[model samples]
Target: MILRRKENLSKVEQKHEKLKTSNMKWTTILLFLCFMGITMASAQQKTFKGTWLYEQGEKNGTIQLDLYQKSVENEFDMDGALCFGTFAFSDGSYYSIEEVEVEGNKASLQQVLDTEMGNFKMQMTYNSADQSIELSTNGANGLPDKLLLRKSDIQNQETSAESPIINEVDNETSSPINWTSIIGAVILIIAMAGYSLFIINKKNEFDQVYTTEYFSATRRSNGKSPQSSSEEDTQVTGLLDKLQHELTTFQNHTSGASYLVVLKKKQHKKCAGYLRQAIEIASTNPEILHDLQQYAHILANSQKRLFDGSYSVMIAAGIATLLVGYLMSDLLIVILFAGAIAVYYLASFAPQYLILNKVANSSHTSTGFLGTLANIVGNAKVITYIFDTQDTIDTITGDNIYRYDDYSQVQASVFIVILAYLVTGIGIMYIACWRFFRNFIMH
Candidate 1:
């Protein structure tokens, strides 16, 4: 009897193990199905790519969906395609759709106004059967729930036919960006930049060395008076005589500087140049040497004002161009600025550095043609500079201010200019760039 009872107990234990194994197998199958369901739902191809219009109890507007823009986001992360949208109500109220979360056919749309997440939530369900979307909203007064929006009839018929071109257009789907073109363009730009630099270096090679040796601060520190040679004295005196002749001959058409301003600057650079040569090789009187040095210093300081002003203008244009380019995301727009600004700016450097650097000024050899024409496209600063008559600071000391007195003034100007241009030139592009960067940095 004991042997029989032990055998029976072992059999029962084996039966219980089999039952547990069967349950485990079924649980595994169920979990696999659930996972697959979620995957399929999320991975399903979806596009709400047409203008959707709804008229439900006087809540009517068009929701334009750009098929080209795909926004994917994971909260507080910055790694998803931007979801682009706009909401225009019949009451002339327009709101931008800033956030989108989609799971299968359902999507939640969100927006923020004045730094606050709006109190309204719009949920949409895409109905494939009707090519329509059912929208539900909560937390907003007088908003309709279960609002149905049909695709525009043309879009509907096109969708029904399912032509690839029509579908792409109707959905506003854009192809992937061709990075190859952009890379090639950038490489070309770099090569051009290098070539420009090389050309400038080759053209002005000796001029640089000559100017630097004479005007360098080290020359100031040396303080060793250059003793005269008879030849140098004769040469410098001849130059001085010619300069005096030019200044005094005020009436004849002898072909010197045209404008009064040009006359003054040419006179200044010539005077400065003459004094420098004279001091290097003229009489050895210390008092005479000191006075020449002082006057030379004054002329040098004054002549530089024109170059300084032009340089300042160039710098401001550069900053504005960069800021505008950096803030814009559209490849076409960025390219436009890069090309125009590059041509406008780079076109001038050859003239400025190699040609007119010895006497850089606005009304002189450096300022008229190459850059100003190209830069006239969009730069406001360039516009002002082209028309600007003031070329010097008079003096940089004793209560003189350059540009604006405070940085806040600069900030305001930048902000205003950016706003104006964005509004006038790039309403849609601005929205697209803003959305792309917003998700990228703050997702």
Candidate 2:
């Protein structure tokens, strides 16, 4: 018995270890992505990249230099940018920008002239800030190897600058997803997710046993009785098969699947009840009656709570689902996380959502979903809608003071309340993950 318990403990430990790895890996990646975003947002293009009109031989020609293709989003170490831009002639002909390099305040641009475009001017179809516009031709030749666009050129020329760059397909992967420093957002998101986890732990702070004793229906839901002896025999045999299957699976479940066994045990009890009812009025052989009684007796007295389910897994998963779904700017990461969640639930066994929710949400039995539901809604409002808001707080507080030409004056600022909510939510997450295996994983 001790050896068996040791094996069970080992399996449980292994399971927990995997969960730990998954949680840590996910959190780390998200933090990294958030930091990358911040670095990129902060390293943003200097005040020098834009259109420059140069007068060469009395011809007024303008050049546009876009630096978005080569992003310094990685570590702000980017010096060379392979950007695409254009210079239009009065006749609607244009030069496509090949590469651009920024030094101090001067941006040096290069364009490999493609004569085959036949004066195909880039119109609404070219959006460099959103997508890279690459010009292609059988043979390329024309514009000078170097054209400089100075930052102080708007004095005599019209200039449109500060356009976001595009995805460049080259030696490196076109779309680079590094980290986040758009950090305020990422930290806020992580903090909110953490708090959700903490609150889930708080709300689910109870244990309750579940059983099929409440089932009122014993006969099959078809509402039709077996018309003949053979039909009755078939029904009896089927029920016996189902009961045996459920019982066998219940008994054979691993230590890791003890919670799933709870589900299976409930199923066995339900099967036993139905099997007994089926044999009640039927012309049952003595062997059948004896078999039904035995199984029912066994199921009636099965031991429980020998093991436990990780109560916070579902809550963690729910928080993870939201975190990955909304926090991750990368679509692939979101899809991967979402797919894992879907596949796990598709099995309909481990981490069973229904059972998990019953355990996690025992706090709201009296108040109904409204209790838990309102709590979750309030948390969301606090995390998202409450902070840095312009007017919702005022509307809620009834602070519509009539003054100063507009209601914004009355609305004023609600940032303090939002900041407090943000800090509280994040703090909860931090506390939930604190050591001693306290909140989320100890079970």
Looking at candidate 1, the ten consecutive residues that score lowest on lDDT are 164-173
lDDT of each: 0.43, 0.39
lDDT of 2 by residue, 219-326 (tens): 222233323256665677677667766653332223544322223435644665666555443523455555555655445333211212222333445455455445
Residues 1-443, candidate 1, lDDT per residue (tens digit)? Answer: 45446546855975776575456434433443443354344234445556788776766877665433333121222353233455456866554455455554666665422113344667778888988888776635455556678887644221222221122221111322222233433443443334333433432111222232343333343343345445654665665555444342222234555322113444655665666466444444344444444444434333221121234333444554555555543445456445533533333342221123244333344443224533443343421112223455545543333443334544555576545444423232222223222211111
TM-score of 2: 0.26
Segments of candidate 2 deviating more than 4 angstroms: 1-49, 53-60, 67-84, 88-145, 152-443
Instruction: Give the per-residue Cα lDDT of candidate 1 at 336.
Output: 43
Looking at model 2, report the run of 10 residues with the lowest lDDT sum: 203-212
Best by TM-score: 2
RMSD to native, candidate 1: 30.2
